[model samples]
Target chain A: MSLLEKISDQATTLTPGERRLVENVIDSPTSAALGTAGELARAAGVHEATASRLAKKLGFVSYAAFRDALRDEFIATRETATRFEKTIAESTSDTILGELAREETQALGRIEEFITPEQISEAAQILMRARRIFVYGYGNAEVLALLMVKRFRRFGKDTHQLGTDPRGLAEQMLGLDSDDAVLSFAFRRPPRGYAALMETAKEVGARTVMIAGKSGALLTPRPDRLLAAPRSGDQDAFQTLTVPMTICNAIVIAAGLTAKEESLKKLDRLGQLIERFE
Target chain B: MSLLEKISDQATTLTPGERRLVENVIDSPTSAALGTAGELARAAGVHEATASRLAKKLGFVSYAAFRDALRDEFIATRETATRFEKTIAESTSDTILGELAREETQALGRIEEFITPEQISEAAQILMRARRIFVYGYGNAEVLALLMVKRFRRFGKDTHQLGTDPRGLAEQMLGLDSDDAVLSFAFRRPPRGYAALMETAKEVGARTVMIAGKSGALLTPRPDRLLAAPRSGDQDAFQTLTVPMTICNAIVIAAGLTAKEESLKKLDRLGQLIERFE
Candidate 1:
């Protein structure tokens, strides 16, 4: 049996200390295999002696033997990933298409970490009760802003979108007050006037939420709620927009869940309206 | 040993038809468990008798016993998923933050399938060799256009972003010709004049490439290259922007990789200019 299966079989019989080691190995076998027994034990919040003892209990002669088995498993998984790449690289169009679906599905799986049900619930609560909500995005972030506005409007929130023009922006900000909320997509290299826009929203006592890159946290006069989606790649190269967009989805979903009754009512009305128009 | 491990261990000994059945079961146990012997055989491109024989070889008394084991594995996976949801559902603020990082990482992984290395190389080659490049997007797409223009400019390409207004938009398209390329983000509910803008670009003999949703294929006067990124959610309830954004990243990365020397040279000059200004 594989070491993982052995650990699973022995799980119920393990002491609390040994259980911790098993969890560590199961969660990150690569790290466990690469490190010394002492290091793995320390990370798992157990003693070195306990770690060695657990290895024997799981049918390993020594901790080193256990680590070697883990190393083998880690190597096998990597080989599988590489084989998948090769299969796509040298294959027909069908495999190429399959590769795309695989990548997207994997992305959705990873996204669970970046956005949680709680964060969604919090953002939803803010949008739900706000007297007025202003959505702003310029450049690529603008699409995210437009989407938010459309979704919130369906839920019966009085939503507004800031235009691309700087000259008319101040006029739009005039009515924002303490009861209002501002959700802005202040992604990398935000427009020159964005800081001023945020400042004005803050001055009017509106709660300002910013969806931006890691650097956004250091900006002058920070926002009330900052959803930081860190850029992945060398600076000055291409940065992805998927992370921020997923957060947007989470917010919309959470809001719908939180205000199910009102949201459904509004959606029902919108559905009827669409049917009538058609 | 686990059923899956047993199959893997005996893989080399199995016939080709049995191997196909094993592969199908491994890839999607839920589906395989739910399917009948006939359906499983049809999917694996084998005889029904072969399917039952393979099950017995795997140590099952009958095909039903093999399916029972698969169903248990499928249920176990779901239980693990539920446990994960529980972990996050009851997690602290720190784990909530980690969720965002996980989701973004997954999205990047999935993006690999939608855009192949070859597609990136091809698109980059087109952008690099074109005499002139016009980047067009309005609403949220405008940001993508602006980003593309900025990246291309850093690589010393003559790139332009069309203004949002219709009158200025027409004037901007006047100088386009066969030697030019136009990259557009024609995402859902494209701005009022998007069709007209594409028509004019094509009329002026420029190649047009669009990054759009699946329905983008139905747009009037189809583009020369249409990179379709399907939406994740329901028809009207919060469509995601990550897929198209990832495609944009692929394009930029491909272009940068293709024009490595020129791109580096232009970036160096840009850095020096910034230093001088500061």
Candidate 2:
């Protein structure tokens, strides 16, 4: 914890008077309390000159040091808030409907943070023209790849998943030529051989895109494009890729939107077929 | 919950007047409000106007706004000082330590926000020398075929993964070729495929690296090096890779460190035995 957080905890546990003193100056500047201990004491409902005394109790030699603690707290709190807010901008947790209003607000923030006409146009163009397009990944990405495959099939692209296989995978790659495009979803660590494939895909003239982490440029040697998630490696665990995944899905949808009228009609038909079959 | 965290939450239940109002403000902007108008009013010891009165709620709106309704209470409470204190330092919940005194103080404050030099080097080195890498990705990375396989083992490198046939996943990928590397694991929506192969080891690979999610990257990429983890995806009733599954475990720890010496020593021993036995 930063000094501010420490002070906050210590302040709250102390006697009301001392706690009051701790609270007021916790976010204050060191200079604020030095000569004005009397003023701060009055403001906090403590002895007129208690600020310095409280500082001493808290282990600071003078009110100036306490003020410094407060300033540090303020800054740390600010930084944390900004980072947390950034994560929330993209975060999509389950069953947060009760927060619809806030959710909408946050959504807007996210949209503004990233959406650009160039991005929409480019992503859309890629989706529209991708030949032999494949959304390759494992885990959650498997489901996403399936969805993309289904979505793109309506546009008349021949897409297939790289199911669990070793030799078969090699054989499959041998069939592809430069005209094909693959959207490989290896965000964080980029899988064992993921980066190697991007290198090969490019060698084979296949267009590849990466949606990944805030680490070494391990994966994308030949990536035609890269989308760095708003949330980096830091907040990954406490939070899942709920935020970035949603953003990527939206990109797919946006790309679909730009794929033109016939594509939408085709999608409807495809959905109808799949629905009927189910 | 860590001791630090429990106390952070308890800070909110405090009476407004009873708290070091300034310190609470610095700690959490929305905290002073209890999310209920009456509760907020009661907590702050003020009328609605007085609560609305402190509109500079610094980080929040009026006290009325902060507690009007719970949108994502989880969001509000999730990232606290303790959580940030660790993750920013790259110290996450994967380990069990939560000691406040022993905590890495500068880790959070000085977090790289991006990847660290050490992490990059470690991941890169892992990928450079894999003899044969077999990646097993069930749900999300089903399409990761060829992506990981073709990437690492490019130019005839022996990188492999589960074949499309789920049944052959174990035996096929485990047939280590020339100091093989096993990169098999599951991701969001864990598949039975990975769980089945968890115990197998590639005779060819020198070492193993396992990457799992917050929940075991849904079951660690078995046999070795672990990367970031546990990104479960739920888009509909189905959350597809909320985080990129394949990429999450894509850490090439071999980028910097070389367990090659030990691996080579074992490989040499195994090769001689295989030659003599065969």
The candidate scoring highest on TM-score is 1
The per-model lDDT (C-alpha) reads 0.64, 0.43
Q: Please give, for residues B1-278, the per-residue lDDT of candidate 1 as tens digits.
A: 44544564565688999988876665445457555788889988999999999999989999988887765443222232344322323322123223333333333344444555566556777788899998888765665676678667777889988887889988888898989998887766666677887888778788878887767777877888777756443344434455666676556655655665433323224233322322
Q: Give the alpha carbon lDDT tens digit for every residue of B37-145 in model 2.
A: 4444455555655444443343245553444322223222212323433433342321111111112221121121111223323443555565555666654454444
Off by over 4 Å in 2: A1-151, A154-248, A254-278, B1-77, B80-130, B143-157, B167-171, B177-179, B202-214, B217-250, B257-278
Tens digit per residue, CA lDDT, model 1, A56-172: 999999988887787556522323333433433343333222333344334333333223344455566778789999988886676678778867876788999988688777788
Q: Highest DockQ, which number?
A: 1
* Candidate 1 lDDT: 0.64
DockQ of each: 0.05, 0.04
Q: Tens-digit lDDT track for model 2 on A1-278?
A: 33433443354346778766654543222323232578778878888666666777767777766665544332222333344321211122211111221222232233323434355346556656767776676644554466566556655667777653555556667767787877766654665457556666878887776655444245546377665544322323211233344445445444545654333322233223333322
Docking category for candidate 1? Answer: incorrect
Pick out the ten consecutive residues of candidate 1 chain A with the lowest summed lDDT. A262-271
